[model samples]
Target: MSAPPYHPVVPANPADADAIVACWWTLMAVHGPIDGRMYETVPDAQRVYREHVRRQIDASKGVVLVAPTPDEQGIKGYLLGGLGQRSKVYAVREVGMIFDVAVHPDHRRQGVGEALVQAALRRFRLRGLSDVQVTWSPENRLAHGFWQKMGFAPLLIEAYRKL
Candidate 1:
């Protein structure tokens, strides 16, 4: 049989920070064009994303997962999702939110993304969270199809404009 879509995903440790941050940079690069391209070139972009990952790892209300190469040579993918606030417009006090999910460009269509999301869903379910939400730009056709395939419904539309 062909090799599995990815290696076993596990809880990220302090030692995995560098690799994880690198993957975060890759993630930002991939979405930079689709989301907001200008900020992608900012010098401090990596720093900000690094701090964001660190906080997610430390949060008791969230989980950060990684899929490393079987030989541990490098990370193949990473996922970041956790408990987050709901605006006053929503009835729920909090919700399980998947803030980031990305697989290495070379590893796409290999089940890495789906597996990571499944793991995130299990984590949220274990915490008694019934509703899990994933946000993506409508302009991102890949995200539109993937999130929908993952059972995400479009409930919010956030628009932005430059003056």
Candidate 2:
């Protein structure tokens, strides 16, 4: 469903932390089955993620942006991306990584997700990084489609077996 109109992507503030954490939990829960079993309860997950995001924000890894609901009621979506070398796990060099991105369920079909991604890319471009990468849960069709639609192609596949 199309989401209500939201503001274009803008830098999020420290005060936006709680809402973003809430959105992150929602994102994880939706993809948990596809990625892995999430042992952390929502509160625990929020605590951990809140700190993680803060560190990223302070480090200037890249950009943290929010798509706020109309009239600044709250955030409808957020994106976390950063500049860094490709993981040693992959045979690639420096690339921008979209660490996290989530949109409220009510805002799924709207353009919020795309706006956040484009905003991230714009930040990367300013940093002189062209190539970028994103990893989504293998079983997440929605994310799969979104990333693909965003012009990202599969560069590597990850396979693992429960020990």
Candidate 3:
């Protein structure tokens, strides 16, 4: 098969919200086989995306980057990050916190995720930020390996339990 067309990450505006939601929904559905424990259904995934992901983007926090198909305007992947001081890893004053990243299943392993990450890093650098951090589940070995390959090292471990 031919390679999908590429586009640089652009700042996600309210106009792009629908596409972003659709892309995130597609990602959850595609990964349901492997990450089904996190999301029970597409609607559940949509609710979380709307309440948590989309709601976090504002003038004070961070920006969302979208990679839309060249032939189509729909999003194929996206990365959300923000400027924050994370004390768990270090005492750094300013760091880019990569909150979420996802690529459509049909587009996985094609460098989309890497491209999104690099784009986010570029944005951070442009904003005069030096450090970037990503948090993921320890059980997700695939994610761990991918982040390591991207030159990220584990700084801390956070555990959770049901009450």
Best by lDDT: 2
Residue 55 miss distance in model 3 (angstroms): 4.3
Error of 3 at 17 (Å): 1.6
Check candidate 2 and list the clashing pairs: none
Segments in model 2 whose C-alpha atoms lie over 4 Å from true places: 1-6, 38-43, 87-92
Ranked by TM-score, top first? 1, 2, 3
lDDT of model number 3 = 0.76
| CA shift of 74, model 1, Å | 1.8
lDDT of every model, 2 decimals: 0.80, 0.83, 0.76
Q: Kindly list the per-residue Cα lDDT of model 3 for residues 63-113, writing each as its tens digit.
A: 688777776567778888888875576666888989778887767887888
Tell me how far the alpha carbon of residue 159 in candidate 1 is from the true structure, in angstroms, after superposition.
0.8
State the lDDT at 73 in candidate 1: 79
List residue ranges in candidate 1 displaced over 4 A.
Answer: 1-6, 35-41, 87-91
TM for every model, in the order presented, reads 0.86, 0.86, 0.77
What is the lDDT ranking, best to worst?
2, 1, 3
lDDT tens per residue, model 2, 1-163: 9665545888988888888998998987787666454333555767888987887777767578999887787898999888788657866567898989999888888889999998899888888777888888767888899999999999899776767
